[model samples]
Each structure stands twice: as structure tokens, then as C-alpha cells.
Target: LKYIYLNAGKINYVSNLFFFQKDILLILKKYLEKQDTYKCFEILKTFEKKLDIAFEKEFKNIIYIYLVITFERIEKGYVILKKNNSEFLKNTLYYKVIQKDIFKNNGVYMYEALHLSEYFLSGYNSENFYEDRFLIDSFICKLLSVLKDIKIRNLINNREFLEEVIEYLRAAIYRVKNNFILNSEIKLDEIENKIFIEILQYKIKMNTYLNEPLRDEEFMMISRIIYKHLIKQKKEKIKLKEVIQIIQKNSKNCYSDLIAKELLELYPNLIENDIDFKKQLGLLDIVTEKNIKFTRCVDIKELIDLSFNDLYDNSFIEVEFTESIHKMLEDKKYDYLDSENMIIFYGKELKYKKELGVSIFFNESVMKIDNKKIKYLILLSNVDEYNYLGVSRDLQKIIESVKFKELEKLNSEKDVMRKFEEVIQGGESGF
Candidate 1:
């Protein structure tokens, strides 16, 4: 099959010959004078320069048509809504084009221009297409792991069918990114294999950067593809409810492990020097297994200063190490403080070096951050940066627990660690 780039000349040749008029363009120009139509032309020029391909007049005209249509629709309170695009592309050319100063200066029509640019660039950007294969490979590996049924297992053996699915997904992701509606005649109820549909949805959500739910039409299209090549190993019909219940029960148990494993797999280099990762799983004994110090401090800075010595004593971090941690705390102090006047400083940036340590600083007197009183400063060295979600989940339980009150009565370091562990473990803190 040939990859042909169609333009308006080929699409509207007959209509153009019959009803072409330049006076219509004059009237339309006045109507769209305030629309910033020049922004579309500028974006197209940059796209052409970047791709090193000259666009014919016909393609440019089609893009102009798209721009006009977008404005007319938006006037009627219509806007395109779809899932986010691939992070790689979004960070690269797509970001550069849209973030231009000219585009941002009252260039409302650039929205449609951006979508039209992506439609062509996604196909023409060879570098992105090459890099996207790694993402696709990772996705397929996850897909195979999720679709464990024996009948579905055989589906991967068909190379043709597999390639078709891959192409379908790539196109679907681009369409969703460009806010192009996926129109399908098929309905979700017609799909017989509901379990497979759920598995497909789970895989897409896990693998891609899509933050929104897929439209039913999109799922219907995907189901049609899978049903086309699906082969049954057994004639016996199984109850859908029973199968779904079983899957859900097992999935809940392994969900966290799956997420952690995927994170480790995706970023092995970041975890290479991570001492905490080398330890046994669930060994985030932040209170009992690390340095604990008690001192009278009136403010967050003093508390931070006291913790630096413990940071060195416990993990042997240098001055720069403390500075980095200090900077992170200073930057994120507002966000880190919980309702219980607690701060958990754990971030992904610290995972790069061997500076892995946990320290707890208990203030004898009250400390203040942003005029709010702070009592306990739990300094967690970064294990996994993304583990903030787990920490947030556990922080709520810890803050509301009665066992946390025992920390105020502790005197010695040993007692502090013991009581702190009791308070933390009692709340079942994930960190």
C-alpha cells in the first residue's frame, strides 16, 4: 500500500471547476479579519521548514478551510475535546510550535492549525515514528501480560493481525490527540467478549498518556478489530459476571506491585544507584530503621539545619547533598505540610545518587512554616519519586490516628524510633 498525502486539489477538483469564485474569498476575508488567520499561515510555514518538505497550495488551502470552520464552530460554543497526546511528541516539535510567542499573542485560530499540523507531522516525523516503536513494544509486553487467557494468548502469534492492531492503536492515539471524533456504527452492546474489551481498556490506560476515558465508539472500533481475528479454543460458554469477578479480585491484590514493577522497568537507570530499591520490598521503615533526633526548634529552618547532621551521620551525604535536600524542602514546603502539621520530604530528584537515608526530627517546642505550627519533620530520602501517591494515601490515615500522639511523650532516641514506628505502622503508612 502506498502512503499518499491527499490535498484539496484532488478532493474538490470537480466542485472547484463548477462553482469557483474569487468574490466569495473577498467576502469571507472580511468575515474572518478578526480571526488571526495569519497565525495559521505562520505555523504552516514553520512546520514546512521543520519537515523540509514544501506544501502545495492545495494543502495550504485545505488548512485554511479548517481554520475558518474551527472559528465558526467555536462561535457556536463548540470546542474539540479529546485525550492528551504522546508525551514525547508533546514535549518536542508540537510543544515548540504551539508555545511560540506569535501563536500565544491573540492567536485563537491556532487551535485548529495545531491539529492540522499534527495530522501531517505525525506521519512525516520519521524520528518520532522510530522512537514511538519503543513505547509500542513496552505496551505490547504489558498487553500480553494482561491478556492471559489461553484463547487470547494465541492471538499474538498472528503477525498480520498483530501489526494491524498496532497500526490501529497508533492512528487512534493520533486522532484522539488531534481532537478528531472517532465515528463508528458499532455499539458496545454488540461486542460479545466484554472481558476482552475491559482488558483492552485497562492496557490502553496503563500504556498510553491518555488521561481521559475513551469514547464508546473508540472501544467499539477496537472490539471490531479483535473480534475479526479472534479464535476460540473451547466451545463451552463461560459466564461473563463470574469471569469479571475473578479478574477483579486477583487484579486488586497485584495492582500496586504491578505499578511499582512497571515504574522500575521503565526507569532502571534512575534506580541503578538506589540503595532503598536494593532492599527487600515493603522495607520503607522510615521511622524505626533510620536516624531519629529530638531538639527544641522554633522554626522550619532550624529543624532543617538540625536534620543535616543526621543526614550525614545516617547516610554520609556531603554538604551539597544537604543543600539539594534543603532546596527541595524550601521549594515544596507549602505542598508537603499536612493538616497534622507534618512534612514528608521525599522526591524523585534525590534518587539519582547513593544519598538514600531517612531521618525524623521531633521539635521539643513548636516550629512554624508559613505561620503554621510544625511538630514532626519526617525527612524521607527518595526511594521512588512517584511513590508520593502512596505517601499521600498513607499520610491521611497517619494524621487522623490517635497513636500519633505518643510521639510527644517520647524522651530518648530509642524510644522515639519505637514509638514512631508504633504510630506509623499503626496507621499502616505505605512509605
Candidate 2:
């Protein structure tokens, strides 16, 4: 067995003729076992560098597996290398890369490896692969947690696809756990949040009934309206039934590609394009068919702010904290009006019974004021930093307080938060 020793700068030296010879590998391992701990790593680096130099030119046949362990040095960027020279290689690739695409100086790892990650995720910035097992495990722990989001989970819709993705992630995780004995000090809060969000999305996709019966005219109006809305928002690939539900509020929007594609998979038919239908209408003048004027805005800010006008009516939803409810608020426009003493509670409150409450605002802030000094607990809008503190008695009193010059001059959002703290601090209710 010819063992290959990982030499210094061998990666730079070897061009394109590198091959993994198990016999050579066995010899190198024997040599490393005889050397000191410090010298063991030197042996590995020498082999890696040598292989890099050899695989730069001509077609090369080498080892089938290049396992890497990334740790502290490169933010845990690890990689696994495999040969791709035939039909089997094409099928194995996460991403396809034709030969003509590799004309640059940083040929193999830089361009080729990155493209390959589209199907397989070994690590980020995988240039820092080394023999350090400990470092690899630590980073892999964080990565697996982060990548557990809906985007990753949704990548595999069915059982087969799910199995494939799990297989890749599992291999990476297993390699780190077994090879690199790194510390697992990742944030639990983040991991839980991501998992919850992923699950919620999965549930939504797996279950929801999205529409109702409507006249052909109403259906056409809905289709046009949905097209206009999605176009205005510049959103694409949205479910047709979801768009339809916006027009039919009573219907549930849970249609799936497997169950039904709705408008996306339907025959084309326009209401106005049919001439025979128009002739059947005897009382055409009495039938009102007014086209509603639609407004289109390209500015995201304007579009978001367009949704902010609902905070004055005291119409808000109560959110409980259990079952990862916080994730349900994503991609929504709601004002959370939190006062020091509001009756609503959201997250920590739901679990283990804490004071973390969530008052989703659809209208005016809801808080009952008595003697509490609004301290610091307040609502935050992801859209912007605007927060509405529950008024002493509603917007009317708030307006009056400002008019009477009783309320001190302050930033609106700041004033709201402060007042919210005061109300929560006090033990009062109602306007």
C-alpha cells in the first residue's frame, strides 16, 4: 500500500493528476502514528496540498471521499471532496458544472465546490478544511441548527425528498460528531424559534381550505384582483387558491399542488371575451359593473406604511405564547400595543407562566390605565420603530392631552413606549 503524505504547499504544487491511492494512504498513516502529535497534522496537510497540485491538469482519478473538519479558524467552514468524471458523477452533483466553466486561477475548490453545494451543503466558505476534528464539530452543531429553517425543510416536500435531504445533513452531522469532538455551545432560543417556524409553515402547507362558491363574474373579478395584487406586490409563485381566498374571505386557503393547482392548472377563459354571455343579460343598464381603481406602489416603505392606518380603532388580536405562536406573526402587518398592565400575554407568559405578553394591534392601543407609571415594556414593529402606547382613555384622550399641553413634547414612538410602561406598571383597566 503506497501511503501519500500531505506535504506543505502540495495543494498548490499538484495541478490535475491527483489520485487517492489506498496503499499510499496506509503508508502515510503508519508514518504519522510513529511521529509526535504536532507532526501528525503536518502529515495530513502535506497530503492535501499534494493532491491539490496534482488534480489541476488533465483528467484525474483519485480518492472517492475527502472528509473535512472545519472549526474556529474559518467560522467552521468544512468540506467533503469527491471525484466527478462520468455519468455517475453527474447524477451525484448537487449542482452541475461543465468543464468549460473552470478557466480561472482558483479552479477546483473555489468554483467547482461552490457549485456542488447547491445540492449538498458541506459548509460555508469551505476553503478551510483541515485535520482538526474538534473545530469541525462545534461549527457543525450551530450550522445544523440554523439550517433547520422552513426553507431547508421545505426543500423536500415528500417522503423521498425528505429522506434525501436528511441523509446529507445527517452525514455531515455524523462526521463532525465522530471525527471532531468540538463543544456544542449553540443558542437554544434561536434553534427552537427556527424549528417552530418551520413546523408552522409545514402545517400551513399540509392543511388549510382556502375559498367559496361565487358567480362567474365574481370569480373573474377575484382572478383579476389576485393577479393585480400579486403583480402590485411583485410576489410570484404564490398559490392561486391563496390569492383566491383574499377575494373569498369565507373560504379556507389550503389547496396544494398535489390536491389542486386551481387557476394555475385551469383552462383559460375571460369574462369579457365571451360574447354569448353578454347577450343573455336583459337588464344590462341596472347591472352595475364598475371597475374598482387599483393603486400600485413600487416603494416598499410606502407599501408597508399603507398598512399602518389600522391602529386607531382599538381592534387587536390576542396571541398566546404556547406552541411556538410567535412565529405566526411573521410576514404580517400588526401593531402590538403593549402597556405595563394590559390583559394580553404572548410568549414566555404562555410557557412556565411569565410576563411576556403580546397585544397584536389592528386598531388603537388597548390598555386600562389606573396608577401605573408606563415604564419600558412596549411593542416593536418589525416594519419600523413605531409603537403605540395604550392611551389613558383612547386616542381622544391622547389627543386632548396633547392639545391641553399637559403631555410633554417627545418622539411619538418613544412617547408610546413610555406610556405603555406606565400603564403596565399601574393596576388599572379601560379608558
Candidate 3:
């Protein structure tokens, strides 16, 4: 029978530690052909929500595997055998709700249904998971609120760590509710702040989940997370203050410039305090202001008349971007350009790296390249190897924008720069 054959394949599949053997893979592929993946995902998402638990982030493949196996078995009339005398639990609200809501139409029998429901609740009910989630959320909220009360609001602004703490509490709550005590080498006394411990203990006692206090291991882990987070916050503040002082001084030294650049990247919101400093930080962005140029050039002949030296820091020469030249540049085989008499390159060809600076030739009149007329040429050369990639990506986006084309017709540098800023601000693309 097909059911027996599939069961034998499944046994092999499980024996291989869930790695799909060729036969099982074939069966899964056949099963998935008639199944909607999205539907399976929806059921999986529903199950997670009902249980108030998440699978691992990359759980889709595993979910689909299990779903395929389970459904295929059911399709072949291989429902789980109902266990005798478990009818009392089958009548509970948790079991009833899950059965009705999740598996009512499915032919998953009593044994399977009971096991599925029990996987989430253990001996408890659905209400327990709901209450546990609420209690955990309230605990985190109150702890954060206490920080606010003590005027330590700045540390609370570390949203990344705050989210980590929230997720940690969620896991801790699950463990505590299930009476799964985590065994850890961490000691509660290791935390230096007695006041912090007392505050945490008070918060824990006040907002206990499921009539159980968090185990010593869980308590110490949570305390360590908070303590480390606070220490990191203090260090960051000191670093920021030092960097700001170095930048605020009337010095244009390399050391100060480097620190300013790093600080700007780490705390971009600091730009709100100083507009001029923000403009200086603009170089940190892929599109540097000094590199953009608006010019009038109708043909290749007109290129000679343009002041290439004033436009870019690197020397410029016009050369055809031949297949060999492009290949040589891509392979980083720079020996071909070793001759002093080698021709210089223009803006659009700068990624080939004959030069090192930014140049945007926003030509008012169309220029001919390989006998094809072009509106603009973007030349992005950078000492940083990865910088060209970023600049090219931004340039490609600008070229794709209809607004950028309109700016080209106007031939206004201001409008082009404003459009760049708009893109940087993550405004609507249509604007």
C-alpha cells in the first residue's frame, strides 16, 4: 500500500536524522506540488500565536518538512491512533479550543490532537501561556518604568538592548511557567549593585508569573544582561563626549576629522545639533557634494574645453572603455596603464579606476559616447574599494528617477542635490 511505503520512507528519513533521503524528497516534492506553501505557513504562524511561542527564525523549511510528512500521512489514511482513557483532558477548554480552532476540519484524531495541544501547554492550559506573556510584558514594562522614575531614561533609549531584554524575559517566562529551571554557573552575588538586585527582586516578587518566582539562574542571567547593558551605555556616553570635544575645537587636523567621521556614523542624530558639522559629515555619505558638477558639453570635442582639473582631484583623460580595458580593470591588472603617456579617462569610466575622486558630468546638451548621445555621466572613484559600489548604486537610482531626468532638463545643481537629500531622508520616491 502507498501508506506503508510512505511510512517506510519516513522511517528512513527519521533514521537519517531528518535529512530528506532521495525517496522522501521525491514524496515531499510530489506532496508540495498539490499544496500551497503560503497555506502551510499560515497554519504554522497560527500555531505559534496560539502557543505564544516562536520557532527559530529560519523555521520555514523545517515547518514545511513536518507539514508535508503529517499531511501526507493523513492523506494516506494514517491518522494517529486515539489513546484510551485520555478523554478527560480532551474535554478541557485548551484542548477543545485548539481542536475546534486549529484542527477541526483536519482528520487529526484524538491522540494527535492531545499531543499537539500538550506540546504548548504541557499540563497547563492556553490561558496560562496568555497570562505568562502578559506577566512578562508587564514585568519588563515596570522595570523600564522604574528606570524612567529614577531619571535613568537615557540608558532606556538603547532600544536594541531593550528589545534583547524583552525577548530574554519572554524565554525566561516560558521556562519559569513550565518549571524548567535553567542551570547556569552565574551567581546572583556576582552582580556588583546590591540596590539593583534588591530592585529586581522586588519587581520579580511583585509581578510573579504563574505563582512561581524565576529560578536563581534565570534571575542572575537577566541581571547580568542589564548590568552589562548599563556599563556599555556609560562607556558609549564617555566616548561620545570625548569625540564631540575633539570635533568642537577649532582644528582641522586629520585625527579630529577621523574622530568626527566615526562619531557621525555611530550617532547620526548628533547632526541635529550642528548644521555646519552635518554638512561636513556629508562626505561620509556615498555622494560627496564636491564631486557633483553641472556643465554644458554637446560633443566629445567640447569635453576638451571643460576644466577637468577643477572638477576632480585626479587627472582626467578621455578614453574609449573597450572590452579589454574593462576586463583589465575588473581583474585589477593595472599593468596595462603603466605607461606615463596612457590616456586619462572621463567620469562615467572612473569606476575602471584611472582616477580617484567623484565627478558628475550633468551635461546640459547631450554628449556622444560610442556614437550614442548621453545626457549625463557619473564618475565615482574612491580610495576605499567598496565606496565605488555604493556610489554607483546611488547614481543608478538617481538615473532611474523621473525627477532626476527633470532636474537634468533644468540643469540646476541645487535641484539635483535636493533630490539626493530627499533620497537620503527616505522620502517617497515619486517626490
Candidate 4:
């Protein structure tokens, strides 16, 4: 009975609460009195009767700690409340809307109003129709979710995005750092600065307030998102010579490791000679060396030969990632994936890296499938836009089938081999 109401979006059940449509408040109040707080959500399902103005006022009492649980659950499109325009997703009846912590009850109302506006304002933000008018809508109820998202939220309010994104990030890094705040005495100030520097370098937001910290859980979420996305679109057309030139010249204007990793994910062949990457984090100091042109730095013959192997071993396919998607990838949710236009791929590399051209994106926001598991990417034109959605079942298969890998696995005793070379050269191995 409750399930039918959630699917019936056109009926304004909450609005009709004034007419005694259903005793939603009675049910919620009983749950609250019992202190079985979790049931607050369960009570919200009673919109089975019809919506009334009182229902919105009643449900807005929900709180925040449940975001971790609720955000993931909403992807199933719950038999839930009418949480309109919440990018945070699966709006809690009591969930409050705070922009840097302010009580804004009407934002949800405004968000719905905006959807109505979009009907006349085509190509602005998409909308759904209700009766004779276009209705603005999102199921998530957090202001930050609706206003700050890269896809649907207003660009003017990106601060909200940064705040939310950083919060998620801070939580993750904080967990990694053990709950110490940024700049606290217990943590490394250098790493904090690195985080700040990267955010600033990427122009994530003007040097406003520090972005919200990502929790370990959220960081884990983003990391998974990045990994899956990179797997689907791993194509790097930038010539080896050009990459080598950037590193050799010691140019400061080089792509970040995020770009490098994504490109490498596409052109798994580049790993043949990218020892600097193996040795350095993000290839920070390695991609830059004075007097080295990418073309002139090393012999491409070895790298090229590796790429032709039917079995790719040199690339990071087997490579472990201590690297993060926090700096490299974006969060993609079910709403983004539900749109059928997104494309998916399994056996190919991205045509281009982050700088542009034939890029791949993962629908990193993981959701349950038949009480099982899946890692998927939604291949599309712009990694950020809603242009397409296609599923890629196995990115490694694409890499393997494309004949992308070239480097053989390094012998753990490769250093021993180097020592042998040193002995042959009349040098000491210090043995």
C-alpha cells in the first residue's frame, strides 16, 4: 500500500494533510515517543494516504547522522517521503537544510518552485511535468545536495559543493589520520598543506573557507568511483615523445598524477619505462627532469614492443592504487546513471586523459544489485555531462583485448640483477 504512493509522484499527499488525509503525525509522534528513532523513516512511508502541508512540517525533524545509511538506501528509490530537490538524496523527514549551518526550511519549497520554473526555461536544468506545469524535482533533501551538485545545482553555489565534497574528504582523511582536525598537532602539517595546495591548484574553489573534510567512508566511496571510471575509458593519445618531453624539460606545467594515472590506465603500454611512477608518489619529481625530452629520454623501442603483447603485464591493471580519486575523480550517483543516454564499455581504453578527448567516467557511487555487487562505469561524452550511459562489464578485458600491456612484471630480484651489473662494471654491491 505504501509502495504505490511513492511511485505516484503527481499526487501531493503531504499538502492534503490539513484535510485529515492520514494521521502521519500521530504515527511519527508515537515512534518518537518510543525513542526508536530509526523508525522515524519508517513513519514517513505513511504518505500512502496523500500529502498534506502538515506532513512536511512534521517530517522536517529528522537529523543528519543517518546520511551514511540514507544516501545509499535512496538509490533504490525508497517507499519514502516526498524529499524534493535534495541532492543529498533520500531526504529525511527531519533532515534540516543548512548552508554553513543555518535553519532554512523554505529551500525545499524554493527548490520545488525552481523545478516549476524550468518548464518554461528549457536547456537550463531539466524538469518533470506535473499536471499542466513543469515541476522541478530531486529526491534528496539536503540543500547542499540540491544546490551544490556539479550536474544539477547552480554553479553559483559551488561553495556548497566544495563544502560537502570536502566534508566527505575530511572525514576520510581524518579517519586515515585518526580523527585529528586539519593542522592539529598529531597530524602531518605537510600533508594538510598538500591537500590544500592541490585543492587550490585545481581551482576547486576560491581560497574561501577550507573545504569540508571527507570521511574515510566517503573517501572510500570516491576512490571506488575513480577506479571504476578509469577502467572504462583508458585511452591516451598524447605521444610518448610529448610525455617524455614534459618530464625531461623539468617543466612545472605538467599534468598531475591524477591525469598521469588516468592516461596510463588508458594506454597501459606507457608503464614500460615509467619507472619514475613506480618510484615516486604521483610521479611528482620523476615526470620532471632537466634536459630530458620525452622522445629523447628513453628508448621507446622497449616500451612499444611491450604494447604488442597479447597478454598485458606492464600496465597498472595488476598495479595497486594507494593513489586517490579524491583529487582525480568525481562522485556519480544513481540519478546520473538512471538516465539512459550514458554509455558503458568493457574492452577499450579512454581515447584521452583528463585534459580532454575520449575520456571515460565511472559511475562510482556504488549501489546494491540483487543483494549482490557490481562495479560499473557510465561511458559518456563529457565525464560531467548527461550525454550518455553504456555499461562496461570488464575494463581489464578491454585492456587485455586491446593488447594494451607491454611491460613484464619486474622480478623482485631485479635489484639483484642491477647489483650483478654493478659487479660487472667493477663496482661494489656493498655485499
RMSD for each of the candidates = 18.9, 26.0, 22.3, 24.5
Candidate 2 lDDT at 337 equals 21
Candidate 2, superposed: residue stretches over 4 Å from native: 1-105, 110-112, 115-355, 364-431
| Predicted structure 4: clash tally | 67
> What's the CA error at residue 88 for candidate 2, in Å?
19
Alpha-carbon TM-score of each model against the true structure: 0.39, 0.16, 0.29, 0.18
Quality of model 1 by C-alpha lDDT? 0.51
> What are the clashing pairs of model 3?
317-344
Give the candidate number with the greatest TM-score. Answer: 1
Q: Write the per-residue lDDT of candidate 3 for residues 1-431, one digit (tens) a residue.
A: 21122221131223322232457667745765675545556665676677555443223344445655666677688988765335645765556655776578455466766655544344233223432332343455456556665555654535445667766766676666545556545554545355356556456543542246666566567667777666655542334545567666856654655555555555654332231331111222644555566777665434423434433334433334333334433333231111111112222233334544545556666654433455554433443323332333344344334434566665566666777776545522210
* Model 3 spans with C-alpha error above 4 angstroms: 1-128, 148-152, 188-196, 208-212, 236-431
Could you tell me the lDDT of residue 425 within candidate 1?
A: 67
CA lDDT of every candidate: 0.51, 0.28, 0.48, 0.27
Stretch of 10 with least lDDT, candidate 4:
127-136
Stretches off by above 4 angstroms in model 1 are 1-109, 112-290, 316-318, 329-335, 351-355, 385-398, 421-431
**Model 3, C-alpha of 264: deviation from truth (Å):** 13
The better candidate by lDDT, 3 or 4, is 3
Model 4: runs farther than 4 Å from truth?
1-42, 47-191, 204-431
Clashes of each: 0, 58, 1, 67
